[model samples]
Target: MKPYNRRLRILCLLLPMLCLSLLRPVPELRADPSAGASTDDREILQNSLSVVEIDREIERITAQQETIQQELNKLSGQLEDKLLQIQDQQSRAGAVIRSYYMGEREGLLVAVLSAKDLGSLIHMYDVYDMIMEHDRTVLDAYQSEYKEIKNTKLAMEKKTADLEEMKSNLIEQRARVSALQQKVDQGIASSSDPEALKKMIEEFTLYWENVGLNEVKTYFNALASAMNDLPEFIQNQDGAIRTNGTTYNIDIKEDDLNAFLRSKNDLFKQFAFHFGEDEITASGQSGTLSLEVQGHYSVEEQPQNSIMFHVDKLVFNGYELPDTTCRQMEEEFDLGFYPQQIVSFVKATEVKSTDKNLHVTLKLSM
Candidate 1:
């Protein structure tokens, strides 16, 4: 059998199992299947295990922080209640003091001092003294209440500030958890599953090559078409290429492509295509495009071989071609081109390939 066919057979045999491994819940550290494996496999296994450990640690910290937050929230509620009570007591104390002083000014002293005779005068004096003493006692009670209220408020404020600090810590802790979760995800992606990773790598490689090829094709086409129409700002030359219904002059030097390609960066887009379907499943910013790629076949005739593409980066020139319509075609078809109609120029920097579907991301400089 051909090398390709043999590779395809191995891949078909291994892929489903590899996918199952990926899908399975990350193994426990002690029970990890790769624990006793070869050196490299053990390294990868240890890395995966470490990620799982970090993720688990993050979760634990998050739970602990959540518990602390709940405590803080509960304390906050209590503080609010205490503050309100303090305010209420202060208000009541103020009202009591106000009424007592107002009433004192309103009468009893003058009434008592104006006693008619001897027996009445003595009784009135005693009554006035008793009233004065009662006023002093009320004032003392108010002062004591005020002091207690003030002290309680200070304590509550301190508790509230501490709770706020704890909440901030909790937020920071949760962010750490989220960051760790992402790391774990990446670790899973990087795990060296040869059969599964192969297709994606091949696809990325091919797609990048395609990006460069398509961009060059597009630029040459546009230049040949717009030679005479170009403004004096752009130097016009005789080197041209022809495509359907158009003659594109290559006014820009060949080295210019290097500059444009260098400046242009690539953005990778990923996609998946199942065995039975001709259509590719993809997600895009604008909308989904219905892409159909020709099938890659194996010698054994068993749909065993598949290719996957991933665009690592996209790089391109910032210059716009004169033909705006063709420029749109470049974007719509994921070709590399500049159009007067487009807001910016795009390029692909890196590309990768695997043995299932094409994925590409083009970087645009607007």
Candidate 2:
């Protein structure tokens, strides 16, 4: 074949391949998950954990303060009731005293001496016994109430002192966490190769895996314990649980969640959760450090109907994490939630978030 003819044939054969390549869709690029582990990676994770753990200690102190406050309130009410009882008992005791000493109501002694027959004497004896019993009962009740008032007042004072101390300690802990967070931020900013370090951090998703999640784990620890002692927040109630035959769905509203959290731990006061368009966003601020996470819930049936909160985005200190980091985070963490952690009466089958609510589907208990 002639050279020109051969070249023309090759071009015709390659033209179809070029056209097909142009028509095919490009695959999305993602972060490399198999990046080799290194010492720097461990340091980043450890730093992240330390910061989060200290922050959680701050939360724990705040929760303890709230508990002390509640106890003091209860003691205050008891003291008030005991004071009223004491006042009423004082009046009763005064009457008994006046009757006993002044002989103002015809003394039992006079009745017995004036008795003219055996029947009259028996009646006098019974009357005296009844008067003595009444006096003794009133005196005993007054003494018991007085003791209770002393105990309640002492407890209230002690709790008040404890609350004040905890409040001071909370301030100190917040300062410490804030300093640690700033140190982490400075280290990231001052790295020799900022982009490379940032890439490594993203590939590992340490911020989501350790920093953001450590707080959530501590919160769940408190919630799991407290819920065991309190009424189930879901089921057998209006606007929360809905049932059809053997299946039920529990709708957990944003307000309801925050309220329950706040009641259990004051750490939730600065943290807020919002539900919007099948997604949940949570943000928390402490001193100069702040973080925000947005995600949606997904169900896993193979693993005992487990529900996971998939992190799609995380913003810390005004920096949005790379998409690669978010994807890695979704694979690694579940935001510390399991249906069994929330309810014991039934098994959860599915979990989905909607605008203003987290809907959980459960099989009715037999």
Candidate 3:
């Protein structure tokens, strides 16, 4: 073959090989199929599990401590009762001793000498013996009760000490778990592989999304427990819902509302919804009786992407709240109303209510 022809043939072969190389699949860094986890993933999972266990331990210890405290309180009451009984018994004994020293003995002696018959003297002697025995029995009962009270106090002290020690150990375990979590978080953050970091984020996001609704429900349940009743819709904000022949409306911010539903205070920072001229703000506060969420959002400026809730009626403490101004409500009634729960990201076309149930319509941005 001619030299030019030979060179052309060689180029054709080289080009196909280069294309094949480019089309070939790149090697992936993956977890072992048999092991079912990558080293980093396993580490993260283990750290998470450790944290959960530590939290459980802390809760158990706290419960135990509370029980111990209750026992201590009961012991205190018992001790007080015992002390009162001892005081009463001591007073009776002192009175008895005083009577004997101040002339009761002389009187008894004179009565015995002046008795008209042996039978009368015998009867007087019997009365004297019975009185002495009654005083001795009271003193003995007081001493027995005092001993029992002393023992209970000692047991209470020991229980308190044990509870303190348990709490200390739980604290140490929590610190350890926290340290491990920090390490795991740092490892994930410092990862140089973009793909790995992305996977981690996706996993976390999926986990949170799955549990988000339930968390919101739990938060509401907690709120109800704290407040002793759910408040009227008007006390909360502007939204409309109808149930059991009643319509309800309130004003609320979308983000704050979702945060309430998700039971997460942090979600409030993610979105801003203006309700008229005012932007909505949300904050969480704990009172002695309940958790309080406060904020306001304008209805006119409801963002296109925000969630909206409408309710027809709200029932609290077996009474349906009237649709009235907040100022008009009874002073003693506290509307434990807050923005919570994100039901959907899609808007609904129709809203309805039933006799036994309050129907709520949720609107979500497409």
Give per-model TM-scores. Answer: 0.28, 0.43, 0.39
The C-alpha RMSD of each candidate to the native structure, in angstroms, is: 25.6, 21.3, 23.7
What is the C-alpha lDDT profile of model 1 across 144-261, one tens digit per residue? 6566656655665665676567567556645654664465456446767655433433343243234423544444343334322322222222332212222222223323332333
Task: Give the top-scoring candidate (lDDT).
Answer: 2
Better of 1 and 2 by lDDT: 2
Predicted candidate 2 versus true structure: per-residue lDDT over 240-318, tens digit per residue? 8677877877788888777876777776788778988788898887654466878887776556656666778776544
Instruction: Rank all candidate structures by their TM-score, best first, as comma-separated numbers.
Output: 2, 3, 1
Q: Write the per-residue lDDT of candidate 3 for residues 122-226, one digit (tens) a residue.
A: 998887678768867876776787788789779878877887897787678667767967876786776676466546544543333343223333444443343
Give the alpha-carbon lDDT of every model.
0.41, 0.68, 0.48
Tell me how candidate 3 scores on lDDT: 0.48
Model 1: what TM-score? 0.28
Candidate 1 weakest lDDT stretch, 10 residues:
281-290
Clashing pairs in 2: none
Superposed model 1: Cα runs more than 4 Å off: 1-92, 95-366
- Candidate 2 lDDT trough over 10 residues, lowest sum: 28-37
lDDT of predicted model 2: 0.68
Point to the candidate with the largest TM-score: 2
